[model samples]
Target: MAIDERSVHGGAALVLRLLVCVVAARAVSAVADGPLLNGNFEDPPNQSQMSGSVVTGEHAVSYWKTSGHIEFICSGQKQGDMVLTVPDGSHALRLGSGASIQQQISLTKGLYYSLTFSASRTCSQNEMLNVTAAPVSGSPAQTGELPTQTVYTSSGWDSYSWAFRAEAGLMSITVTHNCGEEEDPACGPIVDAFAIKTLSQPEASQNNMLRNGDFEEGPYIPPDSQWGVLVPPVDEDDVSPLPGWNIMAYKKSVKYIDSAHFAVPRGARAVELVSGVETALLQEVYTTVEGSWYRLEFSAGDADGCASSYDDGSSSGMKVKAYAGTAETTVDVDFRDAGGSKRGKIEFRATASPTRVVFVSLGYHTKSDNSGTLCGPVVDDVSLVPIPQPYARRLLL
Candidate 1:
């Protein structure tokens, strides 16, 4: 049978489409890498008939090695003289005095990664484990302490995680039981569910130097509701009552605004710095680079109830400010629109390791009769991003 020229071309096109689809599927699969080999300590068949015992030097668990007196647990194995349960699967690694299980993995330098693991107390008094990571070739090491807990869950374990920046092409991570010499050196801590994931780079617009900038974290207040009253000097020092923000009231506690009662420009919540007097909210930008220029963006407005009731001569506004050492910049926002219709921005070069960003309310009480109570300006959806040198110069000019 003679084939038409058009039919021949159609068959060729169909084959090409199928080939492209197969290639795209493989590419998508490569985006997510698997966990570390034997990360759960349950891999490799128990065909060797090796019972639960102390591990030292090289072993069958992929990408892992042992040091000191480490106990390799198997399915249904119980700790010595105690009824400590395994935290995961059928296997867990228990560390005795000075024992450690370590794994070294290759990673990209200057990239961010998150390491997470499950830990629980074991047969000893001081159930302490130190999980640490450092560059194999250069840079400093960081240690996270899961310290001194004598409590153990019957079935589950507490998971701990931390984020770090890679300083070199390879990083070494170790889980060490550091309870020191106790009555029984064999009784130490337990570890399981080890994992490491590379974090994606932050988008230029979403690169916020402050944590919980939108006031979404910390205490949960329903949207459009109030977080009650937060008194002044609340959670002083470096600690923050609102997660990343340290709130200070010049006269009284400020109100935490949620979208439940008002309009939220960014996230679920914002802050009302002044209900009756001036209030300040500050966050230290620890990720800022010295001498680098950064742009600050935020939304400012007033409570919906007071937005249309300025006829009594009561006025409300906000001041958004940033400071790095002695250098600082401030932007004044008028709450005339109410309910977060205005966006404010400012740019400054960082002079310190961590710059301080502050939001102050300039709300005033009414001279005449307007309503029962009045509130200050609202601040929400704050973000900071690094400005390139050329862009920074243009902005300054």
Candidate 2:
């Protein structure tokens, strides 16, 4: 209700108001809670092991099993006495070449769950890790691929997570080190902060088509801002605050604007593709019904605290495109008039298993302040829902 009435006029205004109503009525299931035992590796109850110790089944952390060889790393220990900061806990897990750790959890068939953890390189070189989730109960077993990640932080750590649906009653999660082929085969990946939690059942239109669309999960928020612009290393295609969302900023600044400073139309955060002539944010959404019509609804406007605040005279705009292979929908927006926010939409039929959604800044506006920051389009509250009975619009009325 706290919208800028003047943002859109006449037919456009009416259409947006209806779209917002539809968005609010979408219903989604609730996620169950509780930490998967020793999720933070802060277990063993008051005991911290020194470096260079191997732990396996029965001797490893409670409810965890190991294969090949796994190392026990206590909190405050450096990575092999090197400069790299270790895990933030009383204990963590280390894997060498061919080493792996796994845990099994009881789950309901057809339920969705998310796995999150922290990983860091144990040496000066980069490292890669492979993670998997599969069912053990059903005959023939149902195994699914979870997201695998690489660690290259010279002196820090990074967190990664992914969501998966359970096809059987028991799910086994395994994390393996894939960096043993380097010069020092002993150097591998250090892991900590493990967690497994049930996610709400996904509902299209009622459910969010895009994962982490609100920019809520990602790197820590900086001291002064509500959000942070994620920039990738040179040659890397995607660097984003939210998982599954790729940010394409060729060195230009991007804004992870937060509600702490500006008016967020939906959640606590929004993203602004600032700086470059054409920076983009993109993601692929699964759970689509092939050949079914769907509606994509979202809000777009100018972000605050930048050179081109909404009230400022600078121009801000972007082009939003959604496609499943050949079928696509595109829309353009000019945020100069969007005060609180403006709602926009695109309708299309799914042609593939996953749909690609992209937002790219159309132009580069000059900096409004001393800082050389250009104001760009702000986007948030993106969602996709199936259009019920698209073919049966009217019964001979």
The best candidate in terms of lDDT? 1
Q: Write the per-residue lDDT of candidate 2 for residues 136-239, one digit (tens) a residue.
A: 55543423222223221223465545455677767777788766356765567778776555655323345766677666654333333223333331122322
Worst 10 residues of 2 by lDDT: 145-154
Residues 1-397 of candidate 1: C-alpha lDDT, one tens digit per residue:
8879998899999999999887544322121233455677886424453444755444445567677776776656665565555555778877888778777777777866655566666656556676677876666886655543422122335444445567776777878888655678777777776666665433323567667777664332322223222323333432233555665553344555567766666666676654433456777777788878888787776545343234564544455454444455555655554444467777778888778887665445321224434455667888888898999888678
Superposition TM-score, candidate 2 onto the true structure:
0.53
Score residue 252 of candidate 1 by CA lDDT. 44
lDDT of 2: 0.57
Please give the RMSD to the true structure for each candidate, in Å.
16.6, 19.6
How high is each candidate's TM-score?
0.46, 0.53
